[model samples]
Structure formats: structure tokens, C-alpha cells
Target: MVKYADDFKAMVVQEYLRGTIGYKVLAEKHGIKSKNQIVDWVNAYKKFGIEGLFRKRRHEVYSVQFKLDVLSFMKRTGASHAETALHFGLTNPSMIGDWKKKFLEGGAEALDYPKGRPVMSDKAKNVKKNQKPTQQDEMTCEQKLEQENELLRLEVEYLKKLRAFQMDPEGYLEKHKQRYHSNSKKNSD
Candidate 1:
């Protein structure tokens, strides 16, 4: 069924190239289920070029390759359920979960499709790798307080210096005052 869809998708794209008016008429003429299906093919062709219409089936799931492929498709493809269904020759996209289960239960070899259709990951893999830390990650109260205390200490040091400077130019410059006078007098000389 998936293989059939790939052929059909190629057919649709070919007919579309023959021209839009004739394409719609031929679709209506041929009793194609949904005119939108052809339209989707055309759009996909425009976006991905000819090869986008090809179907892919996994021979095995959970292979580093399979995980990488699935994850990549999920992350980068952003395709709709209809596309996924049409893609795997699946009647429904939910079967992807079946594939996942098979993958988990058996590994890559579990990725068997009905008939002899090969599993599709293209060149990419769909592995679920570790994710980068997010703000949601837990932090200990001690760690949190340590950070705050460090920040507060720095702030206090800054404020203390600011206050001393604000209080009197004399103390702030006591050492510099003599030096300042001497430098000015030396300059005049």
C-alpha cells in the first residue's frame, strides 16, 4: 500500500506537470479520492523536488540509523499526519507508534513492513539523544542560596566602595591629595 502510494504520488506529480487544468480534470476523470492529495504532492514536489515523492520503509527500528532518521524526520520534517501515512504506505500515521514499539521490543530488525517495502529513514538517523539542560532542571536550595550569597557579597562590596567614595573626597583621596598637589606643583615648575 505504501509502495502503491509512492507510485501514485509520482503519477500525480507527473500529471500535474502536464498542466493544472488537465491534472484536476484527469483526477476527477479518474475518480481520485481527494483532489487535495494531488495538490499535496505538487507542493511536496515543489519543495523537495522529484525524490520527495518516493516512499521509505525501515527494515529495522532502534538501530542508531533508525532512531536518528525518525528523530530527524520528527524534528526537521514537520510533515503532517497525512504525509506520514502516505509516506510509510500506512493507512494511518499512528502506526509510527507501532514501529516505535517494534523498535523497542526487537531493535532495528523489528522494523518490518507489510510485503517487502523497505523502512525509510533516508540517509539520516532518528535516535533520541540526550537533551541539553533547560531552565526546568532542578537546582538544590543550597546551590541557589550560594549563588545569591555570592551575588549579594559582590553587591555589598560594590556598595561599600560607592558609599566610601560618596562620603568624602578627603578620605577617598587622602593618599592621592598629597600626590595630586605635588604633581600639579611639579607640572607648574
Candidate 2:
């Protein structure tokens, strides 16, 4: 929405209040897109005088409690967003709508400021800084012993298999071919 100056809004609103011309004709004469904009301005002017028509110079920060209060007031009075904004001296009516949406979606917490990036814990940082690569650091004693035992078992199994293969390479080759052929036939079928 295009922001009109306070004086311009007041002038338009005053002209609108004169009751001679309709909102559509007044909007058309002033090059405003929607008649509702003029209506809103007029409503704001009535409710809040000249101050409601003025745009805020800086961004206004509303606390979570304030947002909740606004929502509660709107619900209690059955007021529209524009009416609620005018009552609260807020420049933008959409802000009340946004607050209502947030409140409905997540209750009160949604109106609070968003949680930013997560911070790393001090213990994690200290651990990372102090850690170094070393043989002992690679594995615990129990892990190292288990790994060595596994390697020895694997080596023994390999030697036994090698001896068996050497003793009967032709027999092993024949058995392997028969096994693979049957498996392949099963797969194809």
C-alpha cells in the first residue's frame, strides 16, 4: 500500500467528511486505487483525529503481552483490525491481523521474539580444542584388543581355507561352478 503523508491524509479525510461527495468519487478525484482506503482513513480520522493518519517515524516494537492484550481487546469488543489499530494508535492495521494470526497459531509464544542461532556449549568447544590425534586416542584398550583378536581369527580362517583350496583346487573349482550355475538358473527363472 502506498503511504500518504499525514497532511494529505487529513486533507482527504476532511474532504471526505464534508459529506458532499461519495467515497468512490473522492478516491477517483485523488487517484486512489480503492474506495476502501479512503473509508479506512476516514474511520481512522474519526476515531483518532489527525494522529492516527500519521505514519510512525520508527518501527514500533510491541511486547508479547501487548500483542496478547490487543488480541484480547479485539475479541472482547468484536472490533475489526483497522478499528483496533486506530484505537491503539498503530499506523498499520495489518499489524493487528498479523498479531491475531500469530496468537491463534501458537497461543502466546508465537508473539514473542524469534529464537536466533544456537550457541555452541563451552564443554564441546573445550573438548574440541584439547583433543589431539594419537595412537592411544584412536581406540580404547578393550576395543584395540577386540580388533586384534578379530584380525587373528580372520587370518587363521584364511590360512585354513588356503590349505584346503591347495589340497583340492579341481574339486573346489567344480563345486564352485556347480553352485554358481544352479544359483544363476534359479535367478533367471
Candidate 3:
């Protein structure tokens, strides 16, 4: 995504409103990639005034319920992403599209987690645990070697499949359809 300065956006919007030039010419003059960018800025300016032109510094986390509500409202009213976003006081309309795509692909549970790395918990910060060694720690050398060999075999199989997927994604997915479905069904059960 391209980040434009608020002043530059305001200037473009102002120039567009002046009515002497259209979006295409203004976009070409200002070296903007898309004419639709001007349209979005103008609409945002009209609906939200100057504050709409400003960039957001921090990400605002929305609840899963809120995302569902936005999607439901869009479906119920048959509103476009831009209209729904404006009604919800959301700065970005594309977020609605993204949510809809995710919901369709993975259902509502997919929206339960937010993007980016999770924060480290206090428990994770502690180096030592108040627990005794497991049975694996007391295993004989022969047993440990057998376990390590089994792990190596699994890793080799995993790498083979990974290479196949990277080489031919569509073919790999088609081949693994049964395995994927079975694993998902087992988890659900």
C-alpha cells in the first residue's frame, strides 16, 4: 500500500473540487497510481471533512462480533464496502472486503484472532518451571535413539511434501484433498 501525506491528499481533493480538471488529469499531474484514489479522498473529505485525509498511526483492534455486525449490515442493506465503512465510522473501506473474504473462506472463527504476533505472557518470561522431568527424560539411550530416528523419518516426509507443494501448488492441493478433509473431520470430532 502507498502512503500519501495528508497535505498532498488535501491538495488533490481541493484541486478536484475546483472543477477545472478531472480525476485522470489530476492523477497524471500528481503522479498518483490510480484515479480512484482521488475519488476515495474526495468522498472521504465530503463525508468526514479534513480529518478523513489524515493517516492512522496505530491499528485499532475490532472485536469479532463487531466484524460480524459490519458484514451482516452490509448483507442486510446490500451496501457497498465504502458506504458500510462510512456508516460504521471506519476509516478504511477495504477492511470490510477483507473481513468478508476471510469469513467466506474460513467462517467466523477465523476472525477470532487478530493479525500480527501475540504479546509475550508473564508465564512465558519465566525461565524455569516448577515441575519434575518427564518419562522421556529418563529413557535409555536405545529408546532415545529409536525416538530420534522416528522423528527424523517424519521430518523427511514433511520436507518431501513441502517441496512438492512449492513446486506444484495446485497439484499438491488436489493430491492432499482427502488428507486435509480427514484431518479436519478428526479435529471436529
Per-model CA lDDT versus the true structure: 0.52, 0.69, 0.74
- Candidate 1, lDDT over the whole model: 0.52
Residue pairs with colliding backbones in model 2 are none
The superposed Cα distance between candidate 3 and the true structure at residue 167, in angstroms, equals: 48
TM-score of model 2 (CA atoms)? 0.52
Please give the lDDT score for candidate 2: 0.69
In terms of TM-score, which candidate is stronger, 1 or 2? 2
Cα distance off (Å), candidate 2, residue 108:
1.2
lDDT leader: 3
Cα misplacement distance, residue 1 of candidate 2 (Å):
3.3
- lDDT (Cα, tens digit) per residue for candidate 2, span 4-70: 7889889999898888999999999999999989989988777667876887675556655456545
In angstroms, the error of model 2 at 9 is 1.8
Model 3 residue runs over 4 Å out of place are 121-189
Each candidate structure's TM-score, on Cα atoms with residue i matched to residue i, is 0.32, 0.52, 0.59
Expressed as tens digits, the lDDT of each residue in 20-48 for candidate 1 is: 56556756865776676667667667755
Model 1: residue 139 alpha-carbon error in angstroms: 35
lDDT of 3 by residue, 43-91 (tens): 8899779987776667777766567656755765587887777666676
